[model samples]
Target: MFKAVLSDSNILKTSFDAISSIVDEVQMKADSDGLRLDALDRSHITFVHLEFKSALFDVYQCDEPLKINVDTEELMKVLKRAKSEDIVELTVDEGNFILTFENEARRTFKIRLIDIEYEAPSPPELEYPTEFEIPFSLLKDSIQDISIVSDKIALIVDADKLIASAEGEFGDAKIEYLHGEKITENAKSVFSLEKIKEMLKADKFSETAVLKLGNDMPLNLSLKMVSEEGELTFLLAPRIESEE
Candidate 1:
């Protein structure tokens, strides 16, 4: 038996929104730090790594940091019916799970429990070569522009401009943002459009996005949030090149 109550369900609400689009199933690991999940999308083209502290929830309790695996797609289908301000209650009974959204009215939804086999992916240990601070909102807007053009986007980081471009049947669309002397780079790489779109969904979440680019290697993205409350970081895996 387990019970968790969120002070503002929207935290998990927005979180699941970005994750569900990428991964069908999610393996959530809960411990003293709160609830953490690190899983890649089905195609393995993108990944979502989220960390939610106990303070985010009004009531948080668990036994031995349980690892709960659930079909995120199915759960999201149910959550989509909820309103933003609704208080969400997630509980499990007899190996059966129930989700309740309580606002001025009480709405309880029942979902058929399905068994999911979950495996956690290990993160790399290499020291990131370069790191930069990016405007969160601008980055998201850039993603929208790229998506309208092609399915893939090439990111060229150099001493001059921070570039995001797409080339396809309709020509090419590129956006160059001039930065201050603070940004120092001399390299570039590319990633998929679908991955950028998924990342944009969580754009408004944090103030500045920390981008760590390696030498023609996978890019690491970290979103940092600072409020009067405290600080939080949302880390995401890089999109490595897919072999043909």
Candidate 2:
């Protein structure tokens, strides 16, 4: 048996809004500690991870560790109906994942679970030359600005600034923000602006995002709650530049 309750639904709603855009199905593990899920998109270009500590919930109980498998779209549909003030409860029984919203009225949704052989992938061990924190809004705006010029954006971190630049036949766009963190080395990588934008959909998850970058390496972006009770992380593969 497994059950968890929260006073706020926004966290769960926003997280899945971004996750469903990447993966169709996901397997979440619930234990005495908390609930967590790690999934790689079908194209294998994006890897997403989400976690919530047991302390974050108003009430959490689990007799034994359980795995909940369900379709992302199905879950998102139900979550969309949840209001900000609604109290959310999650549980699983037999072959269905259950969600209940309580407030003025009680609403219940049961989504059938899918059975499949599964193994969550371990996050790849990575060493980044530069890691810094920037506002989530800054990254979102930068990607939107870059999209106007090109589908691909190059992220560069120097001694004191983070720069996003893109080029196109029509025009080129560049945005730079001074990061007050000490950095010893410079690193740059190009990535799909669309992919990064998808991950940024969880803007409400956190005000600031921590970014990790390396020369021609994948991009690591992570968001954590103010109370440090939850975290959502993404690793996106980079685009290789070919010399003409």
Candidate 3:
């Protein structure tokens, strides 16, 4: 038997909530090191990779090393029932999984074990020419502010600022942040505002989010948790404009 506890449950919860909006099933690997999931969209364009260490959970238990795949939507449903202050404990018995989140009183949630076929795809391996860290809260806020006005927002990053703008039939919205040394770029790429908004519906965003972006590939957004914990990185493919 193995068990571990974490200081914050929202870390995992928030990660799950963000991606469940697009994909239903997600592949998860849980071991002594921690839990990890690399989920990609059907188009293979966008991906969300999450690494959670054993210490992040209030109670992490394992009889043996295991890799399990589950319906992310359903899994999130079970986790949502947990309170912020509750201690979460997971265990497997009789080919079934049980999750108990409790303080004084405990509530047991169980789901049957089912095999879900999954393929692990390699992330883009090219070296990104640009990398920088911005306050996670600011990035989250910028996404939200732009989403209200348009479904798609263009991200234009240079040496001095990160700008988000949208110019659709409904009009336009733009947010520009001036910080750091200015790099070189008069170019821009667009992304789904709704998707970014869905991604930031988490508990804490007080930390910085590192962004690695360049070329015509995907934009990587990485967030770091506490030590002994893992990070979550989201790769979003750029949306190309029609030449019409």
Q: Using lDDT as the measure, which candidate wins?
A: 2
How accurate locally, in lDDT, is each candidate? 0.68, 0.94, 0.72
Ranking by TM-score: 2, 3, 1
Give me the runs in candidate 2 sitting further than 4 Å from their true place. Answer: none
Off by over 4 Å in 3: 55-63, 181-187, 203-206
Q: What's the true lDDT of residue 24 in model 1?
A: 80
Candidate 3, run of 10 with poorest lDDT: 197-206
Q: In candidate 1, which residue ranges exceed 4 Å CA deviation?
A: 168-170, 179-181, 227-244
Candidate 1: RMSD to truth: 3.5
lDDT of 1 at 8: 62
TM-scores across all candidates?
0.82, 0.98, 0.87
Cα error, candidate 1, residue 177 (Å):
2.2
Candidate number achieving the greatest TM-score relative to the actual structure:
2
